[model samples]
Target: MKRFLVAGALASTLLLAGCASGTGGLTTGSVDSISAVEPGMDSGMVTAEGLKTNADGSVASDASGSVSTDVSRSVIKTASVSVAVDHPLEVAPELATIAANAGGYVQDSSNSPASEYQSESIYVTLRIPADKFDAATAEVLALGTFVSSSQSESDVTLQVTDVDARIASLTTSVDRLTALMANATNTADLLAAESALAQRQAELDSLVSQRDYLSNQVDLATLSVSVIATTDAAPTSQSFWDGLSQGWSALVNAGSVFVVALGFLLPWLAILAVIAFAALVIIWLSIRASRRRHESSTPEE
Candidate 1:
């Protein structure tokens, strides 16, 4: 009987311990469930298991492994390139075609014809998709001699994250306000909820606009290209009218240079004139004094 009681007591103790462990696990799971659905969590924070949305509003899993972490980075890219081409006008059209093929567009362009003295040149600004920036730039660079190139990037990740957070918070606020308005009992409560909703909606709209603008800057890479014709590409001959126009322009330019030179020399010329006048006056006074001395020495003749 003593053995039986001891065995029973041991079994009861084990049973109690198992029960306690199960209870603890249940409590922990309940807490986790509550936290998972808790309000005000920043859903914009990308995590290893985080899913991203497609443009069509469909949920998609990240397949690029660690690349998803960089998805949140908002970088604005821009480039300025100076290239020497044999024909700038010809290159301008080719550049436009290249941009079009790259799913880009020419934002602005200026093509100047080759003159008798000046070489033909073109300035074009393109807006290409960020994904195609490198390829587009490479193609553009290959179109002509690479004179110089520079690129710039700005990280707006923090700003984008902040705006997203604010937008989410405001969206929650608006939803709450809308719910309150729906459940409002009195006129005063209804009016107040409406006013709050309006205010929150306005703020949400502004933040969304800002986010969109930032997104556009990240999505489109701006590239400014300057194509200059080489000296060898200059026109070798000119018609009579072309010669006359060139001569006229040269004359005008020469006159402008002459005026500028005269303006620069005017001050020096004035100083020299003053010095010369002073020297002349001194010489004249000296001669007059010498004559007087000679007369005096000549005994008042």
Candidate 2:
């Protein structure tokens, strides 16, 4: 009996963990021949035979161990990318078109015109089908110089399983609570059931919302792209004045930067100058006094 308890606990823990990772949910559930969940049923209610996933992804179960996990979820892929192109404003739409071609669409987008301080930029958020994620990303990266890119993935399989289990538990609980309310002869019990029912309903609604969101995320991958206008290519030809004006600007910018740096260092330089002057005066006085003492000690010459 003790060994059964220990093994059951170990098995349940491992099953829960394996189901949480998306890789094992489908296989784990298949191996367990647990009864199906029906209306007003406890989803996690294990039977006399439930399966546990081993470290090697195999299932192990005996007559004494069973747990129910009927839910499975896919991976959610999200990415953030940045690129530099000749015309950011133009490239934004091209990226949208790429998504459309791949059976996806743009979720959000914004464009900023060029300014004196910075070039034009556009930000876009695209929703692409999971299968088309890589293709769309490659298209985007190819549009211009790939400045930076990052991507991440999330497996909501565990969360879906948890919420489903909770919803099942609450459904049955609500049914029982409703029955109690219907049979309650007193006001207190009736009010208590009503309160519990309301709480359960609220929680159930929230779980449904979460489940829907995860499902959407798993179906469609999200890509956030930032497109910035690349620096202008060096002109093939330039007039003399163009070169002179560019050189003048460069010179003026350098001078201005130098002046700013000098401004910051001026106070420190002044302090050092005063300390050096004082030290020189003191040294001069000490040398003169030493010479007088030497001449006096040498006798009248």
Candidate 3:
């Protein structure tokens, strides 16, 4: 989705333009250096082989091989958290307020009602300014007892750079095409130039839009919150009504189990009952027939 389907003629044009201007590349025009840790140094100090460390503790190399010591990085951050709260239904509003206070907004949210076996829960997605990500997360999670949380940071620096390069190349290409259209001589060349310019312009606009979207994502961090309801007090409600309610729930659950077990055994029980009745009927009929035969075969007494 990052790269568009550049047309054949457009590709050729870009290639020739790149060759002409020497500007078609995806690199950030900087050297990336690797650093390794050497024992016997400071516990947290990192040393690069044959590289000079400046006063600010930045690494540098020879003039012929200057390394990027302060490369700007683009990162997208996201997090998910689940916490047990006293009031799950109110979590969304409180979370929204927190996000707003932190220069953020709630994108989506939902509340679930309490169930027989499960508690009420709230699910919300938030977009907070990246600078406030940690603070907002802390404030939100502090709303309740922290159950669990996880975070992820995606390194989109390379992607951002690539998109920027493509956008720059497209812009240049569009400018060149615009100039060509202005000086086009024949009708055929004009029409072709117009069509190509339109295509390039559209492509350039799309890349610019994508770049903007990517930058927005890097600037704002996303947070997903799952608020699980829990009573402030355990061993709750010594009241008679509460006891009765709990007992009733248990009885209903036990009754449900009994009903299921009965349903499962009903068919087998019916079959066995029918077989027993048939056996009894057959024995009784045989006894009656034998008695009649005996009477018939017996002499008058």
Best by TM-score: 3
- TM-score of every model? 0.55, 0.56, 0.61
Which scores higher on TM-score, 1 or 2? 2
lDDT comparing candidate 3 with the true structure: 0.71
What lDDT score belongs to each candidate, Candidate 1 first? 0.71, 0.70, 0.71
Candidate 3: how many backbone clashes? 0
What's every prediction's RMSD, in angstroms? Answer: 16.3, 12.4, 11.4
> In terms of TM-score, which candidate is stronger, 1 or 3?
3
Q: Rank candidates, TM-score, best first.
A: 3, 2, 1
Q: Count the backbone clashes (under 3 Å) in each candidate.
A: 0, 1, 0
* Full candidate order by lDDT, most accurate first: 3, 1, 2
Expressed as tens digits, the lDDT of each residue in 147-244 for candidate 1 is 88999998876667656665765566566667666665667666766765665577577778888998988999999999997664345577999889
User: On residues 116-226, what C-alpha lDDT tens digit does candidate 3 reach at each position?
Assistant: 767788899999999999999999888988778999998776567656655765577677677666666567666766776676667567667878888999999999998
Better of 1 and 2 by lDDT: 1
